[model samples]
Structures are given as structure tokens and as C-alpha cells.
Target: MTRPAHIAHLADPDDDPFGPEASDRYFNRELSWLAFNRRVLEEACNPAHPLLERLRFLSISGSNLDEFFMVRVAGLKGQQLKEVDRRSADGLTAGQQLGAITEEADALMASQQAVWGDLRNALDEARLHVLRRDEVDAEATEWLETHFREQIFPILTPQALDPAHPFPFIPNKGLSVIFDLVRRSDKEPVRELVMLPVSAARFVRIPGEPARYVTIESILKRFAPLLFPGYEIGGAAAFRVLRDSDMEIDEEAEDLVRYFANAIKRRRRGRVIRLELETGMPEALAAVLKSELGKTDAIITESGNLLGIGDLDTIVDENRPDLKFPPYVPRFPERIREFGGDCFAAIRAKDIIVHHPYESFDVVLEYLKQAAIDPDVIAIKQTLYRAGKQPAVINALIAAAEAGKSVTAVVELRARFDEEQNIYWASALERAGVQVVYGFLEWKTHAKVSMVVRREGGKFRTYCHFGTGNYHPVTARIYTDLSFFTADARIGRDAAQLFNYVTGYVEPVDIAKVSLSPRDLRSDLLALIDTEIANVRAGLPGGVWAKMNSLVDPAIIDKLYEASGAGVEVELIIRGICCLRPGVPGMSENIRVKSVIGRFLEHSRIFAFGNGAALPNDGARVFISSADWMPRNFDRRVEYMLPIENPTVHDQVLDQVMVANLIDTEQSWELEPDGRYVRDEPGDKPFNLHRYFMINPSLSGRGAAIGASDAVPTLSLRRRR
Candidate 1:
């Protein structure tokens, strides 16, 4: 529990003479996140990706923006409304940040529309048409009218917007159409609103050879006469609402489950944060809609053409392999396959690291399944941050529990957007007799670890699995993560202590190998950086390489700045929201930062330090983590950072995984000191890390299958000396 000496000076502006003004030393976290989304949007314009894949990127960008507004922007709006006197790490007030966010988000929304327009045209040219009303032919029109009457009309309820009716509540992200109409009998002007059913598909596919689709709004407009038999339709416009979706848990609530269930219900009706209107909406109509929604302070944008662009993912799901990236089949780790699929046997032989997306996630599942059915396994412990709708992991734990083995599942109910699923899993686990422990109400248990204790030779031996991603199988296929399996007694003991700490609130006194957050993770990381500085001062080669999803903690940024000042070479591969301003002449010239956004998300957390020698050597200190370099991760969540001690596994992670990311050019972006990201250009030799991993087997995964003639080619560092 050693705190860095400079921790006290980090908040003082006058501590470092070489650094810029305290406010100017880092980029705004919110703005940096927007930049990352912009990069995701850029991939939609990248020709290297197949047509459908590019469209998928556009859909992902839209979804990312929605979440950003729901969580990040909603938090700031709350602060602004409460008049709280808090400033961001970069010194922007809540109101100031919102103003800047509005400007940037408006531009981003416009770009998304522009990209969608282009992709729409490309999709049409590829014989996949998203047709306009005018483009619908006679045969398709006849079928669509019939299809709408049968499939969509029954779910529709039109509410007259008159003095007799109060404004109806619009659910979060709900899309609805407002129509100007005239009653045929009295010729009276009237207004009606129809809420689009969330159960209906956003795009209705018309039966045809080319696979044409029409928007549900288009169908509603086309068949307005069918629904309102006595009214003449006039000018109509569509609008979508985005409400505050963040949940606040009542600290004093007697029942935790009841609290979350009520919170989920309340989130749908939370204050409206954004209103997106399709262009050409009459000014009076827009004013009325905004006033009804109580959106005077909400962000209002005239979204062109498409309202909920995230729905474009439906079209991206068309079964046209030609318009998508070639399908890839993941390989099961040879080390486990070599042991006849016995996970414990392979781990007992040696530590193994499985590179996910390239190496199949089935190996992780197999490990759990084996533990569930094995007669020798007497106990199972797991942590669940996000177990998807169809959770095989939960099933395995249930099976073990039903078999009378002691099973403990730490289900975190505050995983944001996945809370409901976690709740369902917790109930199911408890019904199956599994001991379900909801971790600390204040701190989320974000670490991904599973351990099994087996009776062997009249003693218990623990086998552990530590991962940098969720237990969700769907994401495991596309997210680049590491699954480390080990039987080392030190790490096993630490894993048990971690479980004990979360389940029983027993603070670990002397953890041997791994560091836990809300305890000593931050201080330990700072000490590691300080070690590199000491190495440099003693005339030894000093280096550090780290990768994670974000780097927003000010204290950590200051520590890295201190390392850079002491002549330590620091290379960071931060995938998103990096506030650290690298390449600053006197402040951070020795530090370099880059982000990789490509076919697979870079999700693994790794840190390597040169322990008095050059990096990528056997002596370097390498570790894998479940936490990012963010304030909430270090101080507000229960997380773990474990060392890579086995020689082979250490070499595989440091040399292969870390080295490939550092050298990637096609999908990498270098961050400038001024907050802009410049995409790395492939000069002479273009190396794509995703493609390399997809083609080459990882070193540790190859196991005894690796012959002398098939020695894995080594990846070397581009030395900076």
C-alpha cells in the first residue's frame, strides 16, 4: 500500500516547470471519446472493408454515439441542472463541456447521415436496394400494402393530439410519426401521432430478386389512408427521442434486486436528453413536439433522412457473403487439444495463453464444462460482469452446483445495459442451488476470473482462468482478448483471496502475485513506472509498453509524465478516450500514443516494463489486467492486475501480442499533442496485426505441435536508442 511521493503534487499547477499549464497538459476526456467515434465512422468510408462490413461500422458508430449521450452526456447534463461546482480533469465546467459536446455531436451526426447516404447508394449498386416510395414498383407496392395490413396495422394505435388528450409518454429511443390531417366529414384540421412499435423491424423487406427494403415510416406514410379512412393526410414528420438511460442505485434501499428492477423501469421514462427530427418538419409541429416532450434544455438536431441509424444493422444482416468479410473459423488451442481436450491436464503441464478471436473461445467454455462434469472438481468460483442472453457459463456453474459441488457466482448487477440479464442469471443460478453473491453495492466487480479446485493425490489443486474481456461468448469472437490458464500455486492462492475479498469483504493481507484495485492497484502501477525511472537514472535501458481501452486517470497521466521526464521511453496503445497529451516537447516527448481500430476491437490490457534491460527480453516485467487506466477502474471498481510469470506465456504476450500491435500500420492512429488523431500510413511494408494473428498460430497455443522445423518466427522491437 505504498503511495507515490508525487501524488500530493499532481493537483498543483506549479509542480512541473517543464510541463504546460495544468489544464492544457491533457485532452478533454469527452472530446477524446468523440474523436474515437469519429475514427469508427471513418472505417465506414474505408474501401478496404467489404460493403456490408462498412455498413456495419456505420451502425456501430451510431450505437456508440447513443450510449455516449445516454451515459456521459446525461451525467454532465445532471451536473449542469444541479449547478454543481465540479470541473473535468481538463478544467472544463459542466456547462462548457455540454456546449462543446453539442457542437461536436451535431457534426458527428451529420457525418453519420452523410455516410449512410453514401452506403445506401453503394448497397443499391450492389443489388441490395433500400427503396424510396417512388421507387417501389407495382408488384412490390401491392405486396407491401398487404404485408403492412397483416403485420403492422394491428399493433398501431393513433392518438389524436387535441385538448382532450394529454401528450403521450415516449419511451427512450422511441420513434414516432406526427401527421397533419383533415376530418373528411367536417373538413376540420387535426393532428395525430402514431408510435412505431418497437417489436416491428425497422426495415421491411419486400419480396424480390434484388432484396429490396422499405422503411417502416415509409410504409406508414404510404398506407396512411388505410388507417385513417375518413381523414385526408397532410404534412407529416417523424421524430425520435433519446432519454437519460443511466441508473442511480439508492444506497439505503433495503432490497438490492427490487431497487434495480424499479430503476430499470424508471430509466425508460427518464428525462429526455435528445430529440432528433427528420428534415422538412414544419416549424410549428417541431415546436409543439419539443414542448410536449419538455425538451427545452435537451439537444435538438435536424437529423436528415434517417432517425435511428443504428437500425441499419438489420440490413447489414442480409445473407450476402459476397458483401462481407470472408468468414473465419477460430482455432482451438493446440495445447489443450494435445491433451485430448483435458483443460486441467494442459494447465498442469504448463501455463498457456489463448489469443481470442484467432484462438477459439470454445477452449474457455471447455474448461468450464470440464470442471462442471469432472468427478475430481469439488468447488467452482466465477465472476460474471456480462453473461449474454444465452449464457453457457451460467449453465456450467448451475450444473456443478446441482452436482453438489460448492459453487459461487459473483453476479454484478450494475454492468450498465446488461443489468437485466445479470439479474435473470442471478435468479437462475440461485434456483439451481448455486451460491450467488452480488458484489459490493458501491463498487462493481469487473474482474473476469474463474477457478476450480480439484482433489488430486489426497490434496486440493486449484486451476485458474483469468481474462481481459467479459464471459460473454458473442463478444469473445470479435474482441481481441487473452485467456490465461495457470496452475501456479501463488496465483491460485491470490485468486482465492480475490474471491474471498469480493464475497466476504475480507481484505487480502498479503497477496503474493496479483494486485487488486480499491486497495493497491494504482499505487503498485505507479511504483512500476517509478522503477523504469530508477532504471534510467542508474544508466540502464528504460522502457514501458501498455495497452488498454482508455487512459483518463489524471494521477496516472502525471506519473507517466514524470516517467517521460526521467528519460524513460513509454509506448501506449490506448484504443479509446486517451486524455494524455503525448509528444509534447518538454513534458512528454519520450512518450508515444496510438490507437488501433480495425476488424477486431483491441480489448486486452497489458503492461510491460524494462527491468534494467531492453524491452521484449526475458527479464522484462509483463502483466495482464482487467482494469483500464481510468479513475473509475482504479478507485471505484473491484479489479485485478496479475503478472505473467511463466517464461513461454510471458514471451508470447510481450513478444507476439504486444509487438504486433506496436507495428500495425493499416489500422492504427497516432495521437497529436493537440488532440487530433492521424491515421498511420503504411509506407513500404504494411503489416496488419489482425491478419497476421488470423494466419499465424500463437506461440504458446501451439504446444508440442510446434516442431523444431516449425519454430515460430519472433517479433522484435524497433529500438529507439
Candidate 2:
């Protein structure tokens, strides 16, 4: 790929705050995240996608924004309240960034509403009607009335607005109803707020053909007289509040667990960051809400359609397989089956690399199951970060522990939004006799590594499983992550050191292959880059290829810019929140950046660099890590970056995954120095990388012993070498 003249424009200081003339060109972290959300929203508008899937995407986008507001926007608001006007690297003050964010978010909300409108119509044509109050039939209305009185009415507590009643406490992210209350005898009106019952369904499906849906707000409107029988009906609108839900802990406190408990309580009562009101609300009522909530003008928003459309997740349960993509059940690799489901045998036969969803996560599950039943297995060591509903991984650990095997599981209780799930798993593991250890009080242990110590042939051998993703099997269908299984003693020993570092705080000084973070991963990466830079200066062929979820650490970007200036080729596949400004002349002329968005989320952090040779051995380093190239990953969390050494695993990652992503034109978006992402124009020969993976088997699979058939020549002779 050749550099374009637009690179000069990108490098101009005026184009960005950190242009060539200025100090640095840094993109706002919050803005880059918003752009990622926008890309997610774009999926809803993609007509080429399935209608229900598009709706699901919209709901997911909405939920994502809700969290972003609760965390990111709320944090910014806190900074502003503290009179902290620290300017971001993008040269915008906290208040200025907040103002810009409000404008951008408002526009995004409007776009969401517009897209929802189109999706609703499309869904209606497919025989699904999200009905208004007036659209419900008389028979369904009677059924709903009975259902409301029996189910909803008993649980609802409606407080009359008077001297006796005070404003009800609104929980964070709680949806409610606000109205103008007027007396029956006298037509004088006063403000009233009726919090919509949280326990009730957001969408009530009307009993009829094609399943008509009515929102809870609409139902409340239809039954307004029931709540206020004597008072004259007044204007009512639905609203929702998003409060600061991010937990804060007292690091200086004596007990970390107690402090977290206190933090959780405080999080529930966090200050309101956003107020979303129904469309056509009485202006006076809206103003009163803003004043009561202590919100400024910017916090108030008029939601023209549904206030909390994330409830559409209920609609997505419609069992309409025809309207959705064909559900794909993961296939257990033939390599494992050929070994009669012996995970150890399959892994030992040849280095096996399995792609998730396309290739079964069963291999991971089977690894645990095999260990659980194996009489020779002595101990199992694992890390639990975010285990989904019914985590088979946890069950396997429990089984192993119950079977009188030494099982140690490091469970992170501080996984945000997953604290409850983690807590549940921790308790379950404890009950099952598993030695569950909550990580260090200060740092989160985010590394994903599992080990099994087994006695074979009168000797103990450690089987290590290192993955770039979580142990959540549910997410494996969507998130693209990498997993490596090996019996290498050196790698297993390094993993043991990592486990001890978290559970026992014994940091290893020298690691044979693996590089650990919050300690050595950064220096190791920098050293690698330095080696590449030297090669470039030496007039040797050198290049860098890295794939990550996000990149925001300025120091790393600066290092990359220096490497770019050294004539080293740098290609980045950053899925979200990239602060680096690529293709800037004089700054990053040799750098190119692209992101892949497709049916599956583009995850899996892979880092590779050319060894100034055809194959990278000790000279060329390739790593798969669980950490994103961010400040938190480097300084705040415990992480690991393990090198891919085995020949088959190396070739699969380098020649297959890395090469395929670099050449993909479809589903790719290029980020400009101006912080705007431009989708790659379709090539003359359109190539869908995701489709290719779905249809074709990976190189690792084809190269496997079982996949080798009579039609193809055997590679046994080559392997003998």
C-alpha cells in the first residue's frame, strides 16, 4: 500500500490539536469510544443484515450507551464538579469535552430513534407489531386489564402527591412516569411523579396472531384512571434516570471486602448523570424534574419514542429462525474426535489451534472434563474473571475439587457489572471444596491461564491453557478470541509463576518466554519495537503487525511513531478506542490503521513483527495476550503476553490470521488522523473475511493429521524431520 497525499493534511497541526506543529496528536478516549458505539449503531441501519438481528444490535447499542453514560460521562461530570479542568491530550478541557459529548450524544440518540422507526416498520411487515395503547383490541384489552390488576396492580405502590408525600427516591437507571396531577372537584393542577414498577415487564405481549407488543408505559397510560380514580386525568410521560454507578473504594481502608461493600451501597445512590423524558412532555414538568434532580440544562433530554428501548431484548425472543441467521452449533474438531475426545492426546499429537464458534469451544470444555476424570491428574489451577450463566468451566473445577484433586481458582470479585456473577461462582466453588482465592486487594488479575498437573509414566507433566479471552462459553460465539494448549514445561512454569504472583505475590524475575504486565510486558514490547527500529535503520526489511481491542497509551503510540519514522512498516487492527493518528506525514507516514467490524465482534489481541527474515524464530516474536495496549493494562492490572513458539501455532497466527486481517478490504474501517473513521471502499473482488472463515477450514485444521485425507498427500515424512 502506497501513502496518500492526504497524509500531509493529516499531519497539519491545525487539523488536530496534536498535529506536527503541536505537541502530540491524541484522540479523546471518550470520543473514540463513542465512535465505536456509533459503529455498533450502524449495524442497526445495515439493511443487508437480518431485521431481528438489526433490532438486537440496536438494543445492544442502547445498553452500551447507557453504561457509557453511567461510567464515562459520570466520571467527567465528577471532574467538572470538583473544579478539575484538566485538559485531555486532545486539547479539550473537561467541561469543553462534556459539551462536545452532549452534542454528539444527542445527535446519536436522534439517529437511534430514526433507525428504530425504520426497524419497527420492517418488523411490522414481518407480522410483529409494537402496538400503541389505541391499537390493542377490546378482547386483548380485557385480558391485559385482568392481567394488570392481578399481576401489576398488587405490586405497584402509587403515592398521592400532597404534603404527606415526598418525592420518591429514584434508583439509578430506573424508568418511571411523571405527570401533572389535578383534583377531581377543582381543575387546579400540580406536579406528580409515579415511578413505573421495576418488576413489571417493559413490553407486554398482547394475546393475538403475529404477537402484538405494548410497552409498560402504554399499559400504564391505558390504566391511568385505575391509579387516580377521583383526580382529573392530566398529561403523563415516561422517563428514566441514569446515575453514576461506578463503584469507588477506600484504598486506605483496613478491610478491602468491607470497603467494596460500602462502595456498592454508595453506587446505588449515585448522582443522576442523565434524565430521559418522554416526547411532548409538559415543558413546566420537564423543568421541575431538572431542578429537582439538580441537573443542568444539558442533562435534560426529550426522548421522542421509547425512553428505554433496550427493553427490546424481550422482542428478540420471538423464535423466528426464518428472520435470523441460521443458528450454528459449534463442531468439535475432527482432530479431537480422532483421539476419541482425549484433549491431552490431541494436543500432544500436534499443536492444535481451534477457532471458536467455527471450531467448538468444546475443546476447552473437554480439556476440563478430561482433567476432572483423569485419575493421573493431581491439581488444576484456573482463573475466573467473567463466567457467564451456567459456566461449565466452574462446574468442571468443582467436580475436580470434589473428586479429591487439588484445585485452586483465582476468582476476581471486582469484575465490573459482573461482580454478582463472580461472587456467586466464588461461593459455589467454595461450597464444592475448591480453593477459591480472590485476587490482591489493589490490582485485578486479568490474565487468562489454566494449568493441569498430571502424573504420566511415573512423572508429572503440566498441561497449560492460555487464552486471549474469558472462560465464558456464551461469549465464544460472538467474540473472536484465541486459545493455546501446550505441554511445554517452560511455559507451564511461567504460568505457575503468574498464578503465584496473583495468589501469593511472588513475582518472577526471569521468564523464559512469557512476558508479564504491571512489571515486564511493556519493556518487553518496547524492546521488540526497538529491535524492529534498529533493523529498519540498518536498511533491513522490518515490519510490525498488531491486533488489539483498543490502544490509548500515549507512550506506546509515541514509540510506534518513532518506529514509523525509522522506516519500519506498522499495521494496526485496533477494534476500538485507538488514540494513534495513522498515516500522518512526518509523524506516522509508514503506519496504517484499520478495524474490522462484522457479524462477529473482532476481538483477540495478537502482536507480531517481521524478523527481517521469511520466518520469525527467536528473532521474530509473536504473542497472544489478554491485555489491550492501554494504561490500565500496563500499570493497574495483572496481565500476561505469551509467545507462540510451536511451529504450527506460529504459522497459523502469522500466515493465516495476521495475513488474512491485513489483506481484508471488506468489513474494514480506516481511522484518519482527524479521528474520523472511513470505511474501506469495496475492492473489485469483494472478499468477506468472516464469511471466508465460516465456510473454509482454518490452515491449522487442514494441516492436522485427521484432516489429511487420501486425496491429499501425507505430511508424515515432513513431520518426522
Candidate 3:
């Protein structure tokens, strides 16, 4: 192949496929992400949602903001400190972006606090009040006092900030309370700090009929004077700090695992990125905190109530199902049920595409388990990006390896936030004799693939499983993803080739059925966009439909804008941040953008191009990918986008997943050029895509397969007016 076209910056004038007008309407990527998070925080106040679910949304917002601070904010801070003046695609300098981000973050935090207040009141109405230490009844207080002395006081370490005693280390994201203390004999005031134990619960549920509660911090604050007996009681204010948690590893180091362990330890003491203080905190106390933490006034924020609301997740107990969404158990595909749950037999019968959450992940577990025990199976190769505490997938891989099967497991060591767990799995896999390769040092291997090389009848054959999500079963239960199981020779060969490239760096010359990143994924996509533009200019029935977690690559967005301007209808189903502004008068008149937010997370990446023809195979191009349209995926990661050539699978992805997301109004938000996400209100005939998916079986369902035939449903194509 001609050394593929050089990758150009998204904002370069030469790459502006969509004329000048389209560029003007595009929103800044960073700002659009902040807007997406605002929507998440907004969900906490949504009256239509259940109270517990709303609380869960609040926790998600907090966790999301923490990640945003650690990565995005820290990255900007680094760039600014290095005096790098490179502007973002939207033309904003690092300092400018930081200023805008701080303003937006403040507003988001304000909204979060407001929603928390609303949720607290709503929880109170439900007879579950989170009481303060002073508000606790006399009996509850006495019990708590005894409980604290037994459970907490032993772990407490209070340090005074004085010449004699140095200020202790304040860990990242750790909560502490600053107070004024006066000695009995000297009659002089002193400042002190108290660190909250990480392992302890943030809220202590009072023993009562109605279930009142008190914060652990509040209890600690009330009992601080007791810990220091000769000191007079003084005013105290609680605060928390966010730090740069992103890890930096040296590839040249001899011991990768030990280096990471040390890095993890250092992460706890990372430079503070943000400092949150309790509302109405005295200026003196706030100033003391700033000086000690070495943070500027710009980094300080004040909020009402709980500083770390993610702790609310503990309160959303499984015991309270009545206060949450009705628990819906996933159903096994009737085809599997028809075969007495023989995964191998079912998958071998025909290529199948399974939609998760609606369908049970038990089937995936079954596949691996069967392969682990099957005498016919000779070897297995798998790529693991993220897995929960106890992954059945990992167990299956270990079992297969121990059972004398040749298993090669490529586990990415740099899965951000899950690095520690990956390290643990690496050790376990290594112990089991599984060839565990921690991918390339420079790139993160993110493609989700599993291959089982088996002997069938007379010859060795490859059975491949390509997915748009991680192997983590817990996330599979909530994140919307697609899984493709196939016996196609070309696809199997392609998958095997990819494993080779990642493990041994021998890029296959004939990779027709898929596009792998860090090699060809970006250029492949750009060429596809260019082809779509060609068909549009040729006056063919051209259109583009894509769904991903985010869209920040400026070049791709510009191309899509050009396609739209050239009379190609563009429809997008972005679940999170989207920088490309749609529906502007002259810029994106032909483009329409909608975001889907509901009970489950929309995570599958689907791209479709109408190649001047009809439906399935009628010049229609479809692909399922493990990458979002982000710059990192394009440049710094090993990702893949596999074409869905099998007509049945293509129809299921396009006709079902793509179309449903496009029309979903209840959970959909429309994006404006001005970085505003306006929720599509309840109209006369409000259609909720999530509710529909819950009740309506997908096109690949057993019933649909038995009834519907070779004719695949083509989604109604809408075009620019």
C-alpha cells in the first residue's frame, strides 16, 4: 500500500474538507466534554429518575470529575508550566483552555452541590435523613461515641503545625480538617490537621427505625478536642484535595512490576491539582490550607455538604431495590437455550452477534469455559484491557493454560486507574505458564479480541470473537456493547495477524477485513470519509452514520462537515463529548447530532457509510470498533475497526443499534454550536430507545432469525434539505 497519507492536524487549513463556515460552528473539544459532564450532574436532579439512581448519577459525576482533573487539568498544567503555547484545534491556548475549564468546573461543581441538596431532601422525604453529629438523638450519640472510641480513635493521628512538630504529609484526594487549638498553660493558639482514614466508611448509619445518618468527618470534628486533652476547643473546617494521579513509567527499567508498585505509592503524594473547602470556611483556615498544600487561590473551591459524594455509592445498597430501578435479569438467547446452552455448537452453527445487558454475558463465560475443557481446542489467544475484581474470563484463560493448552494472553499494563489490577493479573497469568505480553512500551493495546485455535474434523481452524467492549463482566452488565463470533477464514486470519503485530511486530500485508491503529486505522478512516465525499459529489445516495463515546479528532470532524456540506446526510450518536457542532445554518445544516443517556451506558463504536446504494451489501459499509474517535486512539493506542461483511451481522448493527439510537428522544440531547446540550423534551409521542430495547428483542434475536429472512431492514435515510 502507498505509504498512507500523512496524518494532518484537524485544524490545518489544507485539511479543511468542509469549507470555512463549517469550521466556525465547531465547538471546542474540551468545552464540549465539560458540557457532557454537566448533563451527567443534571441527571441527579431529574425528577423522572428514581432517587437512588439519581444518587448514583451524582457519584458518577464526582468520579468523572476526579478523572478529568487528574488527566486533562494536570495535562494542561504541565503544558502551561513548560511554556508550550500550541493552541487546540479550536484555537485556544493552554492558559486560555485552563481558564475556561476552571470557570466551567466551578459552574459544574455548583450544579453538583445544588443537585446533592435536592437529593438529600428527597432522601429525607423517603425517611432517610443524613443527620449531623449535633442533630443525632442522645441515644444514637452515646452509641456513636462508644463506637468511635472502639473503631476509629485507635486509627486516628492528629498532628499540630508548630516549630516542634512539622506538618505531616497530606495525601492526594485525602480529606482533612483544619482547626484552631489553644494550649491550657501557654494561652496561645495553634493550628492542627487530622487525616480521615481511607478504609473507614464516610457515613455512619445511626441505629434507629427511620435510619438517620451522621458523617464520619462530622463525628471526628466533634471529638477532636478529646484527642488533644489540654487544648481548648476551637472552630474546624473540613477540606479535600485532588492530585495528579497519572502514572509515568520508565520502559528501560529492569523490574516493570516493582517500578509500577513504587509509582503507585508515589501517586498518593502527587502534586495537588485542586482543593475543595467546606462552604463558609473562615478565611484564615482557608489561607492556611492553601499555604500548606502549595496551591493557588484559583485551585480552591467551596461547596455545600459532602465534599466526596462518591461515597454515596455505599449508601445505594442492593437491599433497597424498591428505591432503585427495577432489577432486570438478562435473558439468555433462545438459540443457546435451544441447544441446552452449548456455546460451541451454537456459535459453530452460524455467525452470531450478541447485544449485551439485554443479553446475558453468561454466554461469553460459557464459550471460554468450553474452550478451556475441550480436547479439540489446541490453543487460545486473548487481549485483556480491563476486567473487574474476579473476572471469569481470566479464570478461564488460567484454567486453559494449566490444562496444557497453549495460551498467550496480551494484557495491557497501562490501563489507567486499573494498572494495579492488571499487574496482579499479569503475575497470576505468568504463574499459570500463560505467555503474558505487556504490549509495546509506547502504545496501549486496546482492541478486545479472543481467538481459539482448534482442531476440527481433519484440520486446525480458528474461531474468533471480536468485541466493541472490554472483557469485564461487571461493566458488560451496564455498558452497551456488541460481540461478534465468526468462523470466517479471512476474519480469523486477520485477527491472528493482529495478535502477531502486537506481540512480535510483523504487520501483515493482506489485512483487508479490518483496520488496525498506530498503523492504518486513522488513514483508513480518513480515506473512507474522502470516499463518502466523492460519492456525494458524484450525486449518489451518500450518507454517514456513526456512534462513539467521543469525537475530538479535528481532521475527521472537518471531513464529516465537508461530506455534510456536499449533500451527504450526517447523523451522529455520541454518548459523551462531541466537538463537531451540528445543525448550524450554513456550517452543518446537513448534520444532526444526538446523545443517548439512559439506564445503560452506550459504548459500542459503529460507523456506516452509504456507498451510493441501498441496504445490506448495496454499497453500504459498516464497522464495529474498540476505539472512540479521539486523538489518543488515533495516535497513541493500538486499536482496531473490523468491517462487518456478513450481511446478518451488518443488519443487526445498522438496522437495530444505529437506527434506534438515532431516533431515541427520551434519553437524547441535541447539541448546539454554542456548547449547549438541550434535552429533547417529552413530546406527544416520546420514544425512549432504552425502554424499547428492554422490551423489544433485537434483530439478531432467535425469533427474528427464525422469522425474518435474507431481506435485511435498511434504516430510513434522511438527507440535507
- Local distance difference test values of all predictions, in order: 0.88, 0.79, 0.80
Tell me the tens digit of each residue's lDDT in model 3 across 655-717. 877877877767888876555678987576566666666676654464542222222234866
Error of 2 at 498 (Å): 0.3
Candidate 3: TM-score? 0.94
Q: Report the number of clashing residue pairs per model.
A: 0, 1, 1
- Whose lDDT is higher: candidate 1's or candidate 3's? 1
Q: Which stretches of candidate 3 lie over 4 Å from their true place?
A: 1-25, 249-251, 295-298, 615-619, 698-700, 704-714, 719-721
Displacement of residue 705 (Cα, Å) in model 1 is 13
TM-scores for every predicted model? 0.96, 0.92, 0.94
**Model 2 clash tally?**
1
Quote the positional error of residue 48 for candidate 1 in Å.
0.3
Ranking according to lDDT, highest score first? 1, 3, 2
Instruction: Give candidate 1's total backbone clashes.
Output: 0
Clashing pairs in 2: 18-24
- Tens digits of per-residue lDDT, candidate 1, 1-721, equal 1111212223344433323354567677888899999999999999999999999999999999999998999999999999998878766678877888888899999999999999999999999999976899899989999998999999999999999998899999999999999999999999899999899999999875789999999899899999999999987889999999998877788888889988999999899899999988998789888888755488888989899888899999999999999999999998987899889999999999999989888888899999999999999999999989877888899999988899999999999999899999999999999999998989999999999999999999999999999998999999999999999889999999999999999989779999999899999999999999998999887888999999999999999999999998899999999989888888888999999999999999999988876545648899999999999999989999999988888888987888889888889999877777899997766778888887777555553322332233453334431
